[model samples]
Target: MKHWTEDLDDDGDEPLVRPYTITGGRTTAGRDDLTLITLITAQSSSGTDTSAERHALQPEHRTVLRMCGRRPVAVAEIAAELDLPVSVTKILISDLIDAGRVSARPPLAFAQNGALPDMTLLEAVRDGLRQL
Candidate 1:
C-alpha cells in the first residue's frame, strides 16, 4: 500500500503540520530574549553523546536542530526555512533551549552596548549574501 503522505504530493513529499500543533498550542516562547536576528546553534558537537535526548525531541525540534547544526543561524532564517511564522519558530527554538538541545545569542552587532555595526562588517555580510 502507498504511504499516507504519498497521496499528499506526487513526489512523496511530506505535508507541513499546522503551526499551532508544532508549537504545542502555546503562543509565547519560554524566553523573551529571542529576536529576529538572534543567532542559534545546536549544542550537539561531533562527539557529543546526546542521542537519547535527541530521540525524545519532537520532529519539528529535530528539524530546527539539523538546520542549525553546522553553524550559527539567525532566528529569522530559521523561521523562513521551517516555513513557520516567526512567533511559532521562536517558541520551538525556546523549547530546544530549555531542553539543552540548542543555544542562542544575539548577533555581534547587537552584542555591543547599543553600538552600531561596523561598516566593513556590514559590507562583508552584503558581499556574502551576494555570493549566496
Candidate 2:
C-alpha cells in the first residue's frame, strides 16, 4: 500500500521544514494537562469574521484548525494525521487554544481517579452500538 505521507508531498522526498521550525523551536506545550488522548475541538467563530483570522494563521496551523473544526479529535490522532512530531502538534494546538481557536478536554470515557466507568453505562453503549 502507498504510504499516506506520499500524497502530501508534491515530490517523493522528505519534508523540507523540520518539526522544530514548525513549532518555532519550542519543545514544550503551554498546557501541562494535554495528554495523547486529550480531545480537541474547534471553537465556534460566532459573530466574528473568521476569514480574517484564517488568513493570519500559518498553513500548518490552519490545517490543524480544519481538522479540529469537524469534530473532537484526539491529540495523538492529530499528530499522526499531520505526520508531525507529537511535541510539535501539541505546541500548535496550544497556540490555537490560547487564541480561542480550539478547546481541549479529557475523553468522556475516562472516569475520575482512573476508576472504571459504571457497568450500566457500558451496557447502554453496547446496546446503542448493536442498534447501529
Candidate 3:
C-alpha cells in the first residue's frame, strides 16, 4: 500500500501552509479574556455588516464559527476538534468575538475552585460498577 503522505500529489513533503501564517505572524490572541477552558458560542443575531465581514475572513475563522454555531463549546475543545494549537485557536476565536460573530465566557465557576468530586457520588458509581 502507498504511504498516506505519498498519496498526495508530488511535493507531499511540504505542508500547505505553516501554523504561524494562519495567525498572520501574531503570537498572542490579542484578548486577555480568552483562556483554554473559556466557553464560546455564536451570536444569534450578528448585526448588519456581518456578512461582509464573514466573507473577508480566512477559512480558519469560518471553521471556528461553524463549530460554535451549533452550541457553546470550550476553547480547548475547539482546538482539539480543528487540530489547531490552543493559542492559534484562541486568536481565531478572539477575532470572531471582536467582530460580534461569537460570544465567549470563562469556564464554569466550580472548575475554577479546584474542588474535588463528591465521595458519595464516587462511592455510588463504584458500587454500581461492582454490581455490573
Candidate 4:
C-alpha cells in the first residue's frame, strides 16, 4: 500500500505566503469603530458587476465583497468564513469601506437605555420548562 504522502505531488518546496500578506503587511485596520459583531454590506450604488471590479482587488478583498453582496454579514462571521484572523478581516473590510464599495455598521443595540427583560415572560418560560 502507498502512503498518502506518496500520492501527493511535490514541487521542490516553495515557501507559502503568509496570511498578513493579504492585508499588505498592515497589522492595524486604522479604524476604531470595527468590532467583532459589526455588520457589513455591499453598497447598492457601488455599481453592478462587482465581479468585474474584483479583478482589480486582492483575492481576500474580492472574497469579502462577494460574501457581503448577498446580504449583511458580521465581522466575526466573515473572519470565520475566510479562515483569517479577525484583525485581518477588519483590515480588509476597512479597505472596502474606504473605497465606498461596502458599508459597516455596529450590531443593533436592543433595549436602549438600560432596559431589562420582563420577569413575567421569564417566569412563564420557567413554568413551562418545569411542566416538561
Instruction: Extract clashing residue pairs from model 3.
Output: none
Per-model TM against the reference: 0.69, 0.72, 0.67, 0.67
What is each predicted model's overall lDDT from 0 to 1? 0.86, 0.87, 0.83, 0.84
lDDT of 2 by residue, 4-107 (tens): 88777476557679888888888999789889999999988776756887787878888888898889999999999888889888999999999988999988
Candidate that would win on lDDT: 2
Quote the lDDT for 132 in model 3. 100
lDDT by residue (74-118, candidate 1, tens digit) is: 999999988788999999999989877789999976777778878
Per-residue lDDT of candidate 3, residues 16-120 (tens digit):
777799889988988888888789998876356657766899988888888888888999999988778899888889888888889998666645776766889
User: What local lDDT does model 2 show for residue 52?
Assistant: 82
Which pairs of residues collide in model 2?
none
Instruction: State model 3's lDDT.
Output: 0.83
Q: Which candidate do you rate higher for lDDT, 1 or 2?
A: 2
Runs with alpha carbons beyond 4 Å of true place in candidate 3: 1-15, 46-51, 110-132
lDDT of 4 by residue, 47-122 (tens): 5656666687887788888899898899999999888889988999999999898998865553254465678998
Candidate 3 is scored at a TM of 0.67
lDDT (Cα, 0-100) at 83 in candidate 2: 87
Determine the backbone clash count of candidate 1: 0
